[model samples]
Target: MGYRRLDKHILKAIFHRWIESQSISRIHREEGFDRKTIRSYIELFEAKGLRPGLQMPDEDLDCVLQELLPKNTRGRNKRELLAPYREELLRLVNPDASSGDPESPAERPAEVVRPKTAYLILVEKYRLEVSYETFKLYAREIGLTAQSKRAPTRLESPPGQETQIDYGTVGTLVDHHNGKARRVYAFAAKLSCSRLPFIQFTYTQNKESWMESNIAMVEFYGGVTECLLIDNLKSGVLKPDLWDPQINRGYAEFAEHYRTFIDTARVGKATDKAKIERLIPQARELFRRLKAIHPTWSLDELNRQALLWCRQEYGRAVHGTTGIAPMSLFEEQEQSLLKSLPPVRFEVPRYKPVKVHPDRFFTFEHKRYAMPENCRGQSFIARESGGILRVFDASYRLIRSYPVTEQRVCWLPGDFPKSREALMQGAYPRYLLSRARTLGPAAERLIDGI
Candidate 1:
């Protein structure tokens, strides 16, 4: 009969039957094993001082079996091939080992090397002959390598405490007005506690679009969270820092208007605002499905469909992580906790610093607007919104307001100095005549004739 390996459970059953005073032949018949196999196991147990009537504890039996069974050497030959370079492999994986003992510095290189890279280095430099898989297995067995990943800790937030926001690209779509294809992006917002999502699609991801999307999201939810978590997009965050991030001026005003706080995620760290980060992919997939069904949809129509999907499908469907529908959670548990919206919606404005020229004029949107003579050659803040440009002094005091028109030059009567005002108001001819009269009668007559 061929040799067969018996597990601890099988051996324990055989011993139990033998201890019950069953004959070897009967035990073999009942256990479906050859009589010789049963007799051999009994003989081995007897040799180990385990009498037929004596009861052996499970732990003691396991220990006895461990000592009696032959050691598994299936991969012994492969491990022996790597034995010579074990120290080298360990050194490559553990760069800090060299610093532990200062008495004798490690001769091997001290730079940290990944296991796969180390395996390649060993094959190339040291001429070690072993497959990458074999090297990894042996390295793990010898404790030269270990998994660096650990289970991630889930972040929990109170309802209405925070909202996470992000922007993701949804493929290009044709503009209904222009009939030209434009790259489109989806703006996603999610409440941290409810996993409630609000999605908006736009042709641009500029500062204007960013603020507009945020406003629309808040209006859709009919409330605002206490804090807004967002990625370090240039439109929202001017500079990204771990401790002190610089928020965009317009976005700051938007937050202030809604009585909310703006918090930015760390640069390149998606897990900082994982709630919104997780929504982007799902939003993209939803948009793709919408586009597939309505291939000729315009940007506006696409946005309309996306909002409907968020309300009827995405929001109503149970979330994989929360196991609850987002809209249901929001309506049942989160909506009342949020802060109330302002009486009037915020007017999105673009903030820029503009310098008044020596001629008492400043340029905005390629059009020149005249400043007060006293305010000439000074830097002022220009806030443009609702077809109007409002200029503010350094102290944030109102300077002048002008209609953002298509006219090349925008000026008021008081914008110029007293001296220039005369020239601007058609008084230059009279002034010239007066000067000519002072000069000579002939000059005055010549000026009059001209």
Candidate 2:
């Protein structure tokens, strides 16, 4: 007789009856399974530490059935077919093997051959008859193309200690003013301890937008984390290195203003900021659902909806990994632990390298702002914030500041030479009049009349 394939329900039934202290003969008589089969299942359960009157979870029962069932041997047959070409396959997969000298295997750098490429090579060069799917399967079985099974380390942070931030694209939105479709991106910041997330949608991922989104996230949390783990984006990290990364000037200032540390993830390594990486997909899904409902909504409206979703839907829902609602976790544990917010909100400044004109004026946002006379014909940093354009020397010391205005040119009294100031202000005539008065009354009257 062919072996019977039993479903989970039947196995559960048999296990339940046995747990009730029913005899094997009685179970076979009642359940219609063979006596030997019932005995084997009882023995298997007993070996798994399951005893009579012990409550068996569904998961435990599933494990018992999985071990008891027979595995398919289809992979073994494929492996047998691929065994003859094992050496060739290994040569192809080796990254340092030479293509021209497969037999000798010279040490030369080359791309690791993919499974499909190996399969094609076998079919074309070696005349091996096998399907691509079977070749891939056996390649993994023989460990030629097998992925590493290294388990990832679960990183944990103290409440309010760290947050991970990244940007991900969330479909396009039509601009209200230009009536053109603009690709939108979501800026996501997730607290490492509570798994609480804050998302903002923007049409840009530039330096200003990045700083603004970070500020918004910090304010949303009502505080800041001790450290921020961010991706190596050009807007935040100007140069990415494993040991030392160069952070953007604006972003570094933003971090300083918030009293936090900025840590950049390694290049091409997504696991460095794994928390935010996981949140990105979820955020993208939320935006997808929102877009489906409000296809014609403006960017501002979409952002509002995203915020609402964060609070109501995502925040309230129990997190899969944490097994607690994010909002509840934050409120109960992480909220009080966060670093206190600064007295004033951080203003995102624009940093630019500008050349000072010969007249000691530098152009900022198409408007001319006067720098110190010493700064003329030199390159300096221009920082714009709070309606003031500050010029910084090469040493990053504040040189001077001019009020930002719509006027074509802005200059302070100290920015010009005393003589030039008088000439530009039309004070030369007054000076001549004063000199004439010092000479005689007639000279003073003549200059005044003129």
Candidate 2 global TM-score: 0.63
lDDT per residue for candidate 1 within 51-124, as digits (tens), equals: 76897788888888777665664666766788887766666667454333434565544344556656766675
> Which sections of candidate 2 miss by over 4 Å?
1-153, 414-450
As a whole number from 0 to 100, the lDDT of residue 110 in candidate 2 is 26
Residue pairs in candidate 1 whose N, alpha carbon or C atoms collide under 3 angstroms: none
| Tens-digit per-residue lDDT, 1-450, candidate 2 | 457677677888888998899999989888888999889888888888888998767886688777766464354675577887676666656544323453443534223455555666567565667887788777766666755443334588989899999999877777999999888899999999998989999999999999999999998999999999999999999889888898998899899998999998888888777778877866766665556446688888988988887777789999877899999999999999998888988898999999988877778889887776566699999899999888888789988887877787777866676666667667988777877888899999999999
Off by over 4 Å in 1: 1-153, 372-378, 386-388, 393-400, 403-407, 412-419, 422-448
Each model's C-alpha lDDT?
0.82, 0.81
What TM-score against the true fold does each predicted structure earn? 0.62, 0.63
lDDT at 395, model 2: 85
Number of clashing pairs, model 2? Answer: 0
TM-score of 1: 0.62
